[model samples]
Target: MNYYSFLLKNAFEDFKRNKTRTILASLGITIGVFSVVMLIALGIGLKNYIRQQFENMGSNLVMIMPGNDLSEGGFSSFGSSLATGIRFDERDLNTISRVDNIDYVVPIFMKSMVVTSLEKEELASLMGTNEDLFKLMDLKAVEGRILEGQDISSRSKDVVLGISIAEKLFDDAGNAIGKTVRLGNQRFKVIGVVEKMGDPEMDGGIFMSYKTTFGSINPDKNFFTIYVGVDSEGAIEGVKSDIEEALLKRYEEDEFSVSEQSELLDVVNQIFGMINSVLVAIGSISLIVGGIGIMNIMYANVTERTKEIGIRRAIGATKKDILVQFVAESVLLSGLGGIMGLVASALIVLVVRPFFPVALNFLAVFAAIGISSFIGVFFGVFPARRAANLTPIEAIRYE
Candidate 1:
């Protein structure tokens, strides 16, 4: 047989001769690759989902949130729940409105209030916002008219209900309009029921005019967040810079953050990036363990085949031939293990895709295979070198 045929024949025989050890080693690789594949897929899928939601909200919207650190271009306004930052007020809203590129600026004040609809009562988010916010968010009332400028100017006690909130509060979602709902001891006539948004934050909201709710609750209280709409897509960056510059005049540093869709997407991507890194590190631990397993089994193979090595050397087999044969055996086993791991990862993705969004990561698959190939060679080197260095007489004498 040719040298390549001889090497292939010996490698296949070695794998068959040690079935249990080979399977165990391959299993380690399978588990490691599976972890890497699933975790990365999860991160990518979540990032895409969040980005899509934000894009749906509006491409030209810039969000202003209260925070001192503007290093990352923006801080997630959702972080305000920790009560760690200052709040913006009406003066800030007026100041932002005057910025050249800004088309609309709506202040948002959030509070947890007890809302009662006849006999039903639930604790829900009470949003103090103006009619401009409805247009900014692209929200349409399904049953009745949304809050109008007249409601804000008149300081009318009128409320808008999200579809989910309306269903929960009234007998039927359509029936919610024209009904009276109590917000913290004040009765407000429900004038609108917003269309189903499929967002937990907006879907569960109970909205009223900002001036009305804020004036009644506490006129001095500041807003939690502000949404700004720019006139043109090209003007977002200018608006962001103008906002930062305006805020810097009042506070020693930038006490507020200005962010557009791209900046927010960047923040989400960064967060998911860190999460993916942590997950990848965790998965890589298994790969390291698998590599160690490969090493141990290869060493054992050398010990078991000492007499065979001695016979090969005695029959004019070069040191290089002995080394190549051992290395080939280890590489073949590892390659098979990697292929099995890829199949297992693909199966896992299919099974979980319905429950969790997991994109097929072709790059991760290729990387995993490459890493596996490297692991095989790396762990096989020491044992192969040992087999090559063995003297014929010494190997033959070994029991």
Candidate 2:
């Protein structure tokens, strides 16, 4: 057989001879690999979950809020001087809708009022929006229908209760729909109930027709918040710019802000990237410990095989041959440990998937294995060289 094959055969035999030690060493590597792999999987899963949550809110929707400039000392000074006087009216909406790449535009007006059902009453924040608002913002009715165009044209008092509001006032899901609810002494029929959109305590808000809210209830409140949707993903930035330009031209002020879904997603992804980096750094510590374990075991092996090294030197084995054999053994041990660690990592991902979101990335697995094997070689070199360099007389004399 070839010299390399002979070294490999002897290495295998030595590994098999000390099964317990081999298993113990492999266990250490397995633990390290498992931790690193699991952390990566968890980070990926969390990133995806956050992305999905944002997507559910609306993928293409952008929210524009009044920005306050510290230098100017007011919300109006931050954007355009006209923004201070300009209430987002139908004229503004019409102008924005005419902008190229804009698919839909809707304005929102909010009011805090006491809403009373036949059985009970509660204070809630009511939002007024148009039909396009439902489509643009992913607002859907779980029980009944959303506000219609007729509700806006005729100034109807129809309202859609938030999931939390529906649960608190109504006995069941079905009962909440078609029930009459009084909003700040103004009676309106509840046409729909929003589905439980998770943590309603945080985002629980009611919806109503824009005309009824702005034209009838509070004609004095002229200003409103606007939501705009771009026709396509590629057009989002252009649409935002066009809208800002149009608004600036009309009102002669740049007092508005535009947000894109892609920008929001990028922020979310950056957070996830940071989390993964931190986790990977933490997991690297285990690898260092495993490498130390390898170095220690290789040193011990050198001491125990002193006589064997002397014999090999006596039998026409060159220093290079001896070096290659010992180094091969160390590499073999570490490579085996890495393989086991990779297998354990896969099992860990599978086991923990039900409890937490985990996705097995083959690239990560291969990377872990490669890194562990490299560590083994790096730490194993010194001891392997010491064994190969031992003088035949000195090694033969060693007990």
Candidate 3:
């Protein structure tokens, strides 16, 4: 057999002979790789899920929210805006409606409140918009009809519900229609239950007319957001500029933001990017600990094989040969752990994908194996050098 092949055979024999030590040595890397891969998969899945929901809203959709919502970091800006009492009023909405190349305009007032039915009560997101919201969102009712033009015009106390709120309150989605539910301090009759959209605000919210909210729940008549539909995808940039130009006349530049659906998706990606970086940093700690474990196990192996090392050195084996054999064993052990971690991670993703959006990435697979091999070389060198330095007389004399 070739000298290199013989060295590898010895390494494999070592693993087979000390099964417990091999498993213990590899466990650290296995856990580290599994953690890193799973975290990355979860991040990728969340980004994909959010992107899908945005795509469903169509390319022509534009949004105007209070303050620099996207600029201040996604979701975190909401509390600041509310604290400062900055919001869009009817004047801004009217100005946006007159902008050229725009389609429907829907002003929205959103708040979280308790919604109660005869059977149960739950905390729900409440949205006050007009009939135009349905047109802009392309939302359909599964039970009855959504808010109508008459409902908005006459300030009718009719409400549309998300499917989750419907089931939670009425015991079933189909039973929600024609029922009365208390919204804030007033009772509004449920006119429709909309099909389940993936967004939390849409899936578990209460929808009512902005006019209905006025003089009751929302006395100030301030809106949290405004939704706009452009006549064409090409006209989106123009509409965004026009809306900003209009709102800038009534409020400061920092007081509000105008963005499109795609921009919102970008913000979501940016947030996830930061989150994944943190996860990687945390997972690297596990890999380092695992590498240390490998190093310690390799040192113990060298100690146990001192007599065998002396026998080989006294015969024909060179120091380089002794070094290569130990290093090969270390690398093999780490490689096995990396492969085991990948298999375990893949199995977990497969199981979770049916209920959630988790997916295994090929990049993660290559990176994990590459990192494991590098760890093997880095941690194995000291022990390999120690084993090679043993003089035949001294190693043979040791007990």
Candidate 4:
């Protein structure tokens, strides 16, 4: 074997002789890396889930929200507009509806509250919109029927339950139809159950007529956001321009934003980026613990191999050689553990992907390898230095 390979092989043989110590040391890194990989995968899956939701909502959609929600990087709120921005009203929708190339316009009123059924009370996202919402989103009724224009015109307190919310509150989608559910202080009859759209925000939402919603928490008839579906992707730019011109008549430039689907997706990406960074920090706590274990094991190896170190020294092996050998062994243990963790986590994400969106990416792989090496070097230093500093005569006489 070449010099470095010999060093590695020697470390391997020592591990084979003390399998338990090696496994335990490696196990520390394994668990730590597992945490890191799984967390990053969760972040990636969340972004994917959001993108799917956007796609399901249809293409070339335009949205106007109460904020300068778009960043300089193309769109997402600077966070100031949603807090204190002017909300849109029905007049705003009317003005935007006259915009050429717009196929459908729906004002969105969102409220989060507990909806109670005879079976249970569950928190639900209530989406208030017109019948045109069903058309633009291409939502289908899995049971009963969706809202009709008559429902909005009459301000009827009829609701369409998304599949997840219906099941949670009534124990079955079939049982939810014609059932009475209380939202805030108003009781509404469930008129339909919408099919699962593979998005939690849609699947778990309770859809209601905007007219009826104005009677509940939205008494002033103002909306948080407005959705406009254009006829074609080619029409998106024109539609956005038309929308801005229409709304500018009543609102200031900074008080609102008109966004295309792609801009909203950019915002989603930024959000996931921040969230993943946090997850990595949290997961690294485990990596630090694993590093400590590796450090402890290396210290023990130095004690056990004192005489061997002394004999190599007497045979003209330098202190740097002894240090490098022990450090190599520690790094080998850490790297093996990291690889094992990565493989195990990949298998887990694959198996769980059908139900959850967890994904494995190249960034996660590179990160695992890089972090593992860093931990190996960081934790291996002190123990390797102690071994290197051992006096030849003292180490030889060590019993």
Q: Which predicted model would earn the best TM-score? A: 3
The global C-alpha lDDT for each of the candidates, from Candidate 1 onward, is 0.82, 0.75, 0.87, 0.89
Query: What is the lDDT, from 0 to 100, of the residue 311 in candidate 4?
Result: 92
Q: Which stretches of candidate 1 lie over 4 Å from their true place?
A: 1-9, 72-82, 112-124, 141-145, 154-198, 215-220, 241-251, 312-317, 351-357
For candidate 4, list the clashing residue pairs, or say none.
69-76, 69-77, 70-75, 70-76
Give me candidate 2's TM-score against the actual structure: 0.67
Model 3 gets an lDDT of 0.87
User: Worst 10-residue stretch by lDDT in candidate 1?
Assistant: 69-78
Ranking by TM-score: 3, 4, 1, 2
RMSD value for candidate 1: 3.8
TM-score between candidate 1 and the true structure: 0.81
Clashes of each: 0, 4, 0, 4
| Per-model RMSD to reference | 3.8, 6.8, 2.2, 3.3
TM-scores for all candidates: the values are: 0.81, 0.67, 0.93, 0.85
Summarize candidate 2's per-residue lDDT along 1-399 as a digit string, tens digits.
988899999888888988888777766676777778878888888887677666765666765444322223333244453345346677777778898877677788777778788988887877877788778757678899887888877888788878888877886668888889887658898888776655343135678777787645667644456888777878877887787777777554435555565665775687689889899888878877887787888888889989988888888888888877877787778778778777776787788777666787787788788878887788888888998899988887889
Clash list (residue pairs), candidate 2: 79-254, 79-255, 80-254, 80-255
Tens-place lDDT per residue, model 1, 1-399, is 998998998888877887888899777777777777777787777877677678757769988876644445334544752276678887888788889987788888988878899989977788888888888878999999899989987878988998888888896788998999888668999998989776666777988888887656756768878999999999998998898898887855545667776776777787888888999899888887887788888899999999889998999989999988888877777778888888887887788777556786888888788877788888888999999899999998888
Per-residue lDDT of 98-198 in model 3, one digit per residue for the tens?
Answer: 99998889898988989999878899999988898887778899999999999997999899999998999998888988999987678989999998888
